[model samples]
Target: MLIVGAGLTGLCTAVRLARAGLVPTVIDARRAGSGTTGHSSAKVSLLQGSMLQRLARHASTETVAAYIAANRSGQEWLLDLLRERDVPFDTRLAMTYAVTESGAKDVEAERQASRDAGLEIIDVGQGDLPFPVLDAIGLPDQAQIDPVATVRALVAELESFGGRVIEGIRMTGSSFTRPWMVSTTAGEVRAEHLVLATQAPVLDRSLDFARIKAYRSYVLAYPVADLLNVPQSMSLSLDDPTRSLRTASTGEGDFLLVGGNGHEVGHGGSTQARVDEIHAWASSHLPVDEPAWSWSAQDYHLTTQVPHIGAVPGTAERLFVATGYDKWGMALASAAGELISGDILGSAPAYAEALRAKGIRTADITETAAQGASVGGRLVGDRVRLAAPGSGQTPPGEGAGRVEGNPVRPTAVSTVDGRTCALSAVCTHLGGVVAWNDAERSWDCPLHGSRFAPDGTLIEGPATSDLEPVTE
Candidate 1:
């Protein structure tokens, strides 16, 4: 079998299959931990902020129960793996805090949903935050970790079992026969089963992109001292422009991780300004010094709020895909690993069976329509904005990018390190007019969340090909 990603989900799935006497080849576009999993806050908890409430609203009661079961099972499996590997992790209370009245209502709703999903959460008048919180829900014994370390440990275990990991190779396309064949930049390979564990399935057969919304968020690590009074627990906000907090103990010493300020990919402007927004918030709220390092990550959110973890429809079960964790990939992906492995081994659990039972609910249909309308509106609005008279802008300076030329034949031009390049501004995956993400210096698609480098190279997302080159 061949797995086409090496993040938590892929590695977890690979480890399970390998332990069962299957020699699986895991392929990553870059080295292990080069995807979204590495950039996460690394908080693995069943008490995800308001997630149960959102799920209950969009799915059946059984489905909500199944979702909770899957996450709990995944959480347990991960703890076992950590114990076996002897990787030290911290156990902390997980809190969802609301600072505003509106946010308090969200907390109330989530509290009820948690009870329905079988979690015994307690109300806390005050969480260990430097700022005041109106109300908070605390779930004890949740855990945190350095995600990069976890990925490395998973890879080591996989290798010990004779599993092969190939890096710097992209899965461009595939063909299914007696044995499926995957085409790649490195070469062609054959496998009995193919698993697409990427953020979104590269294979477009199921139209996965249209079924979900893609978003980009930022994470900043800053040096903090005892003066900050940083909490020893994991916490997330139920407010807009969400704030998540935790700590990392590294060779450089302990640091604080502040993450939030998410926006739909390619639709928002001034990525640096978003980073600045976070910096300002942290500076005012805590004793956060200038960020030691900052990075960004992209994630997909299913309109239904339930992850898709089964075989790609119409693939005869030979082709499988797992995605839509909605920023809770650590636990959800671990769950997905066990579920997918069970399906392949012909011994799936009842929770897995419950998760797979499918009949589109009213919530799903409504969310799908809303997502479609938003995409459609963006498609029309972006084209008009790019087509307006005098829309062509000046060539961007070094370390910047801008759209030029008319909308019918727009060009994405960027200058990085004193070198300038131009490419078709239209996203290769869909016709959504690409926007310049000043932060990453990449061309990003507003409609479906595809991204490309300054020189027209694919970075991530559903687009299998790089942006087409155009005249400078």
Candidate 2:
């Protein structure tokens, strides 16, 4: 067996298969867990936002039930594995609060759907939370674990089981023969099957990229003296520009993680401003001295608020993909691993129905043009237009200057004391024009919320690589 990523999903799959007396070779472009798993705000909960309601509408009750059961069972399986291994994971019963005024209806509908699916959901007004909640739903046996620790433990276990985890090895592509051949920068890995579990599938042409939109989310971890009245909770707002909130603890102190303000992969504006907004919101709710760590993560968003798990559509026999988690990758990834494993072993999984449900098709070119026109209209009407060269007489900041070229395509020329250096205005993240974030003194991506330091180091992503420098 061969796994393309070494994150939680890849590692877990490798471990499960290895323990069953199969040797799985897991190769990651970077160190294990350094990808999405290391940065995840690992919350194990079945109360995915508005998912049950959404699923119930299109999928059958059995399909929805299987979806819920698979996730719930995956969580139980993880907890049991941890217990058996004596892994010190923090298990807490958490509640999902719908904060918007009209969220009551959504929460009620979701609770009913969950109950119909044979899942336990305690109502907000019921004895679920200790404090007052506007409208909430509680999954009885939810959990939270330190993802880094869990990954480390899993890596150790995989080593013990004689599974190979090779880091700094890139898997470029693959070919299907009798077994399977994965071509990598290092070499070719031949195995019976392949799993593409990377955050954004590098093999873009295999699946509909539009079916899964990339979204970047920010997290600010603060060191608080005490946790205060805020219990271990995870929340999602129902209003437009949805936001999520959750809290976790570290040896230093308890930290609050706020996520959201998402746009399509290359469509949001100003990463630092977004971070500042999160900081401001956090200040009002919780006391913070300084953020212990501030970072961001990106995930694939399914239009239907569910994952796409199975063989890549219109592909050969052995290639499989698991993506479109929509900010619920931790639980969904585990479920995908189990499903993929079963499929490979020639057994049908109970959750396969959910995976087989059709995804939303991409818009046609004419429709796409209309959508682009609408977005362009909004951009023009908005006050904050894209930055351009010499748009105004004043420089962008103390160290930044506006060079004459094109305002829309203005060169971001920087000076150290009084030396000149110029670079392309386009952000490499998603080609959204880059602008100077005066407050942070960094290049900001207007399209997908990636931030780069003054010298062009990636401070945040969907774009893992740094900006390319322009030369005279």
Candidate 3:
């Protein structure tokens, strides 16, 4: 078996197969801990912020119950692995809060949904939060981990089970032929089973990228102060401009992590300004100092609010995919690894079967169409904007980029650190025009969420190919 991606899902599945004596080989474009896993908030809990309520919007009661079961199983499997490997993690309550009326409705709905799904959730107003909330709900005895540490531990355990891991390898796609040859930057290899654990699978056959929305959020970790009133649990706000709070301990000291201010990857304006707002909010609401480290990570959310974990529709059961965790991958991805491995080994449990057996709702179909329509609108609007008066070559200043030319072929031009370059603005995934992200100094697709560096190297993908460098 070949497992692509080295994050939580890939590593966990690799470990599972190797322990079963399958001797799976794992490959990562970067490294085992890169991608979303290393950057995650690392909360292992069933009480994901308004997640159940969101699922209940279009999912059947049985589907919701099955999702809860999947998460619980994922959580238990991960926690057990961490414990057995002697990796240190924290056990605390996980709470969701809302400050606005609409947000309170979401919180209440989530509380009721959890009850229906058989989760012992509590509504205690707001529990031990430094700031006041109109409504809040929680699940106790949840867990949190240092994501990077957890990933490293997982990789270590996988190796101990006689698994092989190769880094700096990118899997482009699989062959159209039988025996299912997998293509990668390293070379082509034949495998009986191929699993794509990458966030929003890399291949475009399923059009899975279009099924999920990509959101980017920032996190600032500040050194703990003498009088900082840190919350004892992982806390999240269900309101617009979401807020997530937790404390993490490192060798230096425990630091307060303030996270939020999420927007779709390429749609938001002034990413730096968004980062600044997160910083200001944290400084106002908590005892924080100059941040020790501040970073950003992006996650995927499905239109139906349910993760899609199964075979790629056209792969004839030879290829499998796992995605659409919607920022709750720490648990969902872990569970996915178990389920996918079980499926391959012919030992998949009831919860895995339940997730696969759930039927799509009319609302799910509508939601998918709406998401596609939003992408279509963006594509049209971007081209129209480019064709406005004075729509010709104009150089951007340092740390800036803009699109030029007509829809036949648009060029993305940028100046970063005094080096100016022009590249194709057309996203290789589906021909959508790419937008420049000022904060990250990259070209991001507003359509399916592919991202490229200033020089046009592929960063994220449903687009396996890089943007072409155009002659200026």
Candidate 4:
């Protein structure tokens, strides 16, 4: 077995495979836990964001029950593993709250759906939270783990089980024979089975990439002296602009992770603004001297809210993928690994039906259409505003100029200083027209937080990669 990533999903799958008498080889572009998995908020709860009702609408009762059961079981399995391995984790009950009074209906619907699905749910009125909450539903036995520690433990076990983990190896692409072939920068790895668990599937072009929208969320860790009063529960808000809070113990003191400010990848505002907002919210909630760590993470959200697991659609016996956890990767990743491993081992999994079922399509056609409009709009808009190039006047920057045949289309040019520059005025992360930030000397994504240097290097990310340079 060959796993393309070394994150939670890949590591879990590797461990399972090894236990099942197969020594899987796991390879990562970077070191283990360097990807999205390491940066995750690491909430392991079955009470995902309004997902029960959504699952009830589309799936059968049995499927829904299996779905719930799988995640609940996964949580327990993780807890048992941690206990047996002596890995320190926070195993606490999780209460997902509906912030707005209007969200009461949705909360009720979710509770009912969970009940129907044979899962336990408790309603909280007062004294359940450190601060006042509108209404909250508590799910018993939900857990929170240090994702990095969990991955390290898993990796250690994997090594003990004779599984191989090779880091600093980048998989450029793949080729298929009877068994699939994975081509990495290090070497060629041929395996009877291949799993693409690399957050986003780098293979399989037929799969709708747009179906899962990527979102970047910010987290601020603060040390507060008063720890006992702070609830040891994981929480999520049901409001439009949602926020989540979880607490963890550190060597310094007890730290509260205040997370929110999510927006589509490459489509948010200043990164600093989002970080500051989270910090401010955390400060208001508790007394904080300074943020222990401030970082951002991107998650792929499926339209259906349930994770897409199992074989790649329309293919059999070869390639598989698991993605779109939607911030529920802790449980979802484990569930997905179990399902995929079962399929590999020729065993029937309880959650297979739910994993194989087609998910709700949430492609942003409007966003795509708007992008088309902006590209065309900017070309025409810029032409009318600025005069044609003259003898002495150069373009705005190194590559900021009109193409010869098509004056509207801009092209990126390389400056003598070895910087590749783009001519497009509109920031691709979001449709906000990017203005040059003189102080930073970069193009900032105004709608969501993404920054690009003058040469188009991604300085700060919510945007994973740099903007595509405009070509003639």
TM-score of 1: 0.96
lDDT of each prediction vs. the true structure? 0.86, 0.66, 0.84, 0.68
Candidate 1 lDDT score relative to the true structure: 0.86
Q: Cα deviation of 287 in candidate 4 (Å)?
A: 3.2
TM-score of each: 0.96, 0.79, 0.96, 0.80
TM value for model 3: 0.96
lDDT ranking, best first: 1, 3, 4, 2
What lDDT tens digits, residue by residue, belong to model 3 across residues 205-292? 6667567888888888888864246787799998988999888888888888888888888897788898788888888888786888
lDDT of 1 by residue, 1-472 (tens): 9999999999999999999999999999988888899898999998898899988888778888898899889988987898899888888899998998888899999999998878889887787898889989999998897898899889999999999899999998888463778998899989888999888888887667778888899999988766236877789899987888998888787888999999989877899899999999999998777999999998899887789997776777778889888889888889888988988998786898777774677888898998899899887777667734333555579988877677587778889998988888888877878888988888889877888899999998887788999854
Clash statistics: count for each candidate: 0, 5, 0, 7
> Residue-wise lDDT of candidate 4 within 363-457, one digit each (tens)?
33444345446445643553455445432335445423222212443333333334545455444543444434432245654333345666666
| Model 1: pairs clashing at backbone N, Cα or C within 3 Å | none
RMSD (Cα, Å) of model 4 = 5.9
